[model samples]
Target: MGDFNQSVVLEAIRRSGEGSSRIELAEATGLSAQTVTNITRRLLDDGLIREAGRTINGPGKPRVTLRLVPDSRFAVGVHLDPAVMTFVLLDLSGAVVRRTSAHTPDMEPRRIVEAMAATIDALITGSGVDRTSIAGVGIAAPGPLDAEKGTVIDPPKLRGWNRVPLQAVLAEATGFPVVLEKDTTAAAVGELWMRRASADDSFVFVYLGTGIGAALVREGEAVRGSTRNIGEVGHIIVDPDGPSCTCGSRGCVEVVCTPQAIVAQAAHAGVFPEDQGMSDVDAVEARLTELCDRAADGDALADGVLRQAAAHMSVLTAALTNMLDVDRVVFGGPFWSRLADVYLREIPDRLERASATRAVRSLPVDGTVVGDDVGAVGAGCVVLDSVLSPRASALLLGH
Candidate 1:
């Protein structure tokens, strides 16, 4: 199953959904008929796939359709956000079998790992699935990650999370191999899997969590850069005259596009009070929600603040689209849903105005089909992906 040929054959059947005949698989994967026969035989014997039914394709003999066994394997995906931690159990078919979420504990990194291990235990046990059927756990965490070391390198949102070796430690604590992924990249992978996009589909995933980041998808694959950490847009100066950032830059995405930044704008506009300090994540989340609600209810000041954010975000979007030349733009993360209505309404026209290819094409902007918990769902799918859909590329998993 680790072979590239095997991955091609298995992915063909998985994508077929209704099922595919051996002849269809051979043609779809460009594998020889004999090779497809041998691989399908092994897959059926191993219970990863099964003969669903027989089909008559104007043939001499009826062709047996092969389909993936959705329940044959399971995976755990965890989204480690500073505000909330989301968990999901996914089957081989990429369906969420069970899920849960909890507020993140403000503790040391090791203590948070302990909490993750415990929650993963309850998620599997409560679902009544055997432990051995579980493949591994995938952690979608905030980045500048040391992918080779499997450690997160001081994400601003997660206090005290320095160079913690998350992959090795979580594997030891849970007794399952762990994969650490940048939350944005994981969300892109999750969208790729769930969206079932065409082979030529491409987009830039704008992940709006505690921070703002981007992920690339090219030819239906997540494009993780050299260090497995691309799309670090935090310090990209979006508004030269906007607020100052920790990186000693003014109007960076971290200071202008993030929820905290939006909340700061709201407070400054007197749409909301700034009693809670700007660094408080939960308070920022609540305030952001309220600000959105106010805008929805026709509060002009609140709308004005969000529109300004959308304008700054369009600057970021134009930068990415002009440089990358993707097919479209996708928005997702824990904070994406609340911001969707305004962002959708506001970002398109501004982006169109700033687009490098506006003359050739009108760039499409849409929210993630997988919704807010996409980070967790995509993390779980990452584990499943490592198993079924292997890529012939430089993509690297964080240990």
Candidate 2:
């Protein structure tokens, strides 16, 4: 179990934060001092960790402290949206060491896939990190996804993404393992990595992007159902007589709360000038951000439009809290960064008044500070989990 102990030594240092002395590592891991020294030597030779400093522990000797060398390896995360594709490169410590973005190409999947491969190759080469040290790549696209097979299975956001073997294709190009996850789940994972919060053993992440969805994470793993679509909160019919969704439903949460719906409502209210480019969720969000800024600065028309959007969002929050029974709700994606204040103020009130369990308990909602990069950063964390997590790593290593 030399390798296992070595891995544990590295993880212990990481969990202990900045640096840990040899004695600290031995105590923290319940391993012998000689075993820790041996593991640290191998880690140092592998360039995975480096000495941070030395502490004088006794009269005769000083103990060297060890810390992760963030640049030891890199993992990449790609978030695919209709309007823009965000790429993030994270070092071993799960920090975004580099980032790049580009406009999403037309609806052709092949062209978009090729472009993604090219972009990744260029980024890796430019950074000059050894290819072997690249642990894995995580791709967070919309669902319903075939998580087992790593396929994108008919995501409403990407029209032609049906049955696409994105994981295998990307693995072939990058020569590293690829993990495919739903965008909302990625956002939840991102929140976990960023917050390192242990508030609950179980929580739900409400992701507001092109559409609203929830990712239920329990005990450090996302919950996927038999069909691999456990958290499709967007299609949860909140109002049967409301509005028709493209899924042919009358008043699903997505139909009323998506960015597209907000922009459409704003256009109908004579807020935005037109709806040509606002068709894209990202474009609509950018426009909405501008509108929110104007509204916050006292634009009467913009204020009304944003308020309407916030009201719809509030309704969705109330419905989710009632259904999920989750104590903690993490608000994520690009929308949270711009409209978090709006949701934070309006949602709790709505939940208190309308939530089914309001009389029994209070549901606390908070927006993730990780913001727009949450999905990308969370994707990187997913890959790191594959390497470090007990279950995920065992499966990956075929032990």
Candidate 3:
């Protein structure tokens, strides 16, 4: 009947996975059966939900099951890294239907926005999904951003993106509502939504990309700090006596455990060719992938560099987990595929030894189920979350 009620009913059906009955929806949402019936009628009429046969119990009347129509809606997710831009189209179920990628172009805000809009247009046209059914675009970009204003504020490696009104620009360019979020936070949202995490689940998502960062998710919501810049983990000091960081700190995680740092370490360890110039993002990514491949193939020097990076990552991760009192940690991002094995193996042991709750609970470290595209998919989930997920603010507004 209203936005709040609609979101609650839809969320219940989506969370039900296979399907749910009105009785089940009423129980899950804590709404009256009459209210669930009215909302279900509206959803059915709107084609957002459909009857999926019936469940017949022994002596009672057969109850009809309703399920979300995945084709009823679609959302586009864009993950903009310093090196690459990933685009994904996701359905109501958070399944990626079509995906594409391109090298990040110039840092000029207008050009980047136009390029992204063009890519979105191409994706929608290629997918042949009804244009009206498409929700909007969600962007996951490197942050230190003004999430409330949808502005990019001096993120590393993006030279010209200083206080750029990215959300408004993208909205204007594409004629679609836009939701902008930090890449790590968006990745955490994606994991929570895609995995259908209950409100009780809590975890920290470690995002390994060109730079390293993290997002703390508690009760299925990402912890946005006072300025909505909570996940700046790169600056966390891991080694007090190690190399100096650009943040004017010694042995910061960003300076020691990032992809750039790992590649630099590999180069120093004689993993790359002497003449190879790691001046550009592409060069660094290429060299890093080569190093990971070599390490996987039993190159001792490369393996040692990666293991050392993983160890540094574990320290930061353990600290975050202990401070936040979360039981799980998830790793994801473009660089994650290359470093997942090392992190999984190395982080768990370090966490077990370092965590304050080690005697009470064993923390689990795992990779994202969405794989390397978790950030992009999470971006898309941001849009769906905004539209379908119920929020406390709605109750305050009496929606």
What digit string (tens of lDDT, one per residue) describes model 1 on residues 94-153? 999999998788848877988899999999999999899999999999998999999999
**TM per candidate:** 0.96, 0.86, 0.97
- Candidate 2 segments whose C-alpha is farther than 4 A from its true place: 1-9, 22-42, 56-63, 199-201, 239-241, 273-283, 354-362, 392-399
Residue lDDT tens for model 2, 286-342: 777777787778888877776766677667766766676777677888567777766
Model 3 collision count: 0
Specify the poorest-scoring 10-residue window by lDDT in model 3.
Answer: 390-399
- Model 1: what TM-score? 0.96
- Candidate 3 lDDT, tens digit per residue, 224-317? 7787788888789998987898888899987788887788788787887666676588988988888889888998898898889888888898
Candidate 1 local distance difference test against the native: 0.91
Model 2: lDDT equals 0.77
**Candidate 2, after superposition: displacement of residue 2 in Å?**
6.9
The better-scoring model by TM-score among 2 and 3 is 3
Once fitted onto the true fold, the runs of candidate 1 whose alpha carbons sit more than 4 angstroms away are 393-399
**Residue 101 alpha-carbon offset, candidate 2, angstroms:** 0.4
